[model samples]
Target: MVPVNPDVTRFLHDGRLLAMPRRWEHRRVVARWLAHATLPDLLEPLGERELTDRLSELAADPVGARRAMVDLGAVHRTRDGAEYWRTELTEYDELVPDDAVEDATTSEGLHRTLHLDGRRIESVATFYDELDRVFMAGEDRRLRPGLDALDDLLRGGFGAAHGADRVTVVWHAFDRSRDALGFAATREHYLAMLADPRFDAALFRGRLADLEAGRGPTYAELVLEVFADHPGVELLLR
Candidate 1:
């Protein structure tokens, strides 16, 4: 299947970018498309001059394009800026389903099940709402969605007297959820954190930098990592 560039063709004519996008979100999408179009192979690193020359084909300002790509977390370069490559991202375009079989029992039937509907999780805000419905059901403690909060919840503090000995989280329509929570969403999530004084500005700033440089994990991956850290938590992506 031919991969489609997301809403960026409007800025192009005869395969050349007409102009830079004014909106930051539009700029991020355009820059991300530029990085993918120019650097299809993540393993192959291009020299500074070579990369600029390739980017020059798309935009008048190759240097600016490079900067935008770096700023959007589409590409990365060495400290000396001698070499450049595309930042790695989870490909939602083609999702290969997970084949791991669930364990049938959890030691004398202490198994509990939770349902996470990915279709309802369109944004970080909605993601939290769904979490509240599933994990905080019948509990008065409402959680503000954040990684730390999520981590604490995974430790079984959501009105639970004790953490479940074994539990399985069946994430329905997992691909759709992953698509909704992809690069753009994760970038914006961190960007919001960076602006909010309530969050750890320093931590979020570093995370944003890493994300823009493609050195950081996506929000979904971060959540998975949190779940992985706690034993007896099984996630089944469907």
Candidate 2:
């Protein structure tokens, strides 16, 4: 078992550090870093005072820490030069789904399951509508698009009405014409998709043969990835 670092633990658990700072940039940086750094990672190398000291040194240098935290949204400076916790700057929003059932008398009960395969592709609009219905009904549904073109077609949106508990999006090469060329093209396409404004989607690339061979993360990981990638459709992860 790896040891934990006490300074990082104290840094995270201490109420003084957790308080929100006034600067929006600082808060954003803190939120972003906190969101990405898990408790275990912070605790790794348990009882390693040397490692902890390095972290402490970084924390002590407010300017350096602020820059590192910038990626996570924590960019503030105090009189003493120490950083305080802040909120993330992600652009999450709330919009009522078009298919939400209004009144109990006319409301359809929740639609829980949606299976996407080649056959279901024809009713794409209805599929999206049903996603809205399920989300409004307070259920999280994982969405996985096969290609960048497909993800673009859906406008980089889809998820539960509420918010995501866990979500991820993965892109794998399943039916490319040539193995080597297909792999490179698939990765490039996925990177381009990530940059698309209409497609604020995450990308996960895996071996096409491995996926086709049925050796990969469990079904749950796949579902969670779909949920994580589509914050607009994050309610599905719940």
Candidate 3:
């Protein structure tokens, strides 16, 4: 049978089970496709068991797929697990589907998943500013929150800026973020993120050494250099 979504064709290159994509952009596309194909929006708020049963029919990794849907803002669930509903995010528009849920966050349609919000941009100095307070407070608890904001800046503004100004800002933010991540307050989160299949510890350390050696790497260059063209490094912000 033809795949319900053609964007999924790349992963379906094997022409059997839909293999998962390693690239963040492709993974997000596939995630949205799964979210639509499963029709979670059409159902009433489902129990965890019911959702899992439904998802299992759609993918080899039903559980991971569920979490991806949430992260993509395609669905919503109460914290207590008693309820979940299709999200209002209608902004995702890479490959359009007729039955696609019309949630507010939806972007273009069907195939697109990594909706880069122009409004999420921030100056690199903002990262430094947040970390300075955490450093001065002598508290680790404030570390993750500070880093998360920095991650947002990088994600939203990653490719938007260029030239010397962009480089300088990124370098400064990278240094500050490194210090914050290395701190005890946020070390565990940083390490756990390394375990993500996407994060590259070797590339990260090599880039750090290069930066310390006065090599050139604005945030964009550094991430692409170390994270293989994806900001898998930012996943550490969690």
Point to the candidate with the largest TM-score. Answer: 1
- The sequence of per-residue lDDT tens digits that candidate 2 reaches over residues 42-160 is 10122223323434533444334444554443322223433232222122211222223211110122222221221221223333443344433454544443433234323334433
Model 3 weakest lDDT span, ten residues long: 161-170
Worst 10 residues of 1 by lDDT: 93-102
**Residue 97 shift from truth in candidate 1, angstroms:** 20
Runs of candidate 2 with Cα error greater than 4 angstroms are: 1-58, 71-149, 152-238
lDDT of each: 0.71, 0.33, 0.44
Tens-digit per-residue lDDT, 62-165, candidate 3: 78777877776656566775555553332243322242112222221121111222122243343344333322233334323333444443443332221112
Clashing residue pairs in all predictions, respectively, total: 1, 29, 22
lDDT of 1 at 69: 88
Question: For each candidate, C-alpha RMSD in Å?
Answer: 16.8, 16.8, 16.3
Full-model lDDT, candidate 1: 0.71
Can you give the lDDT of residue 213 in candidate 1? 94
**Ordering by TM-score:** 1, 3, 2
State the displacement of the C-alpha of residue 164, model 1, in Å, after optimal TM-score superposition.
Answer: 3.5
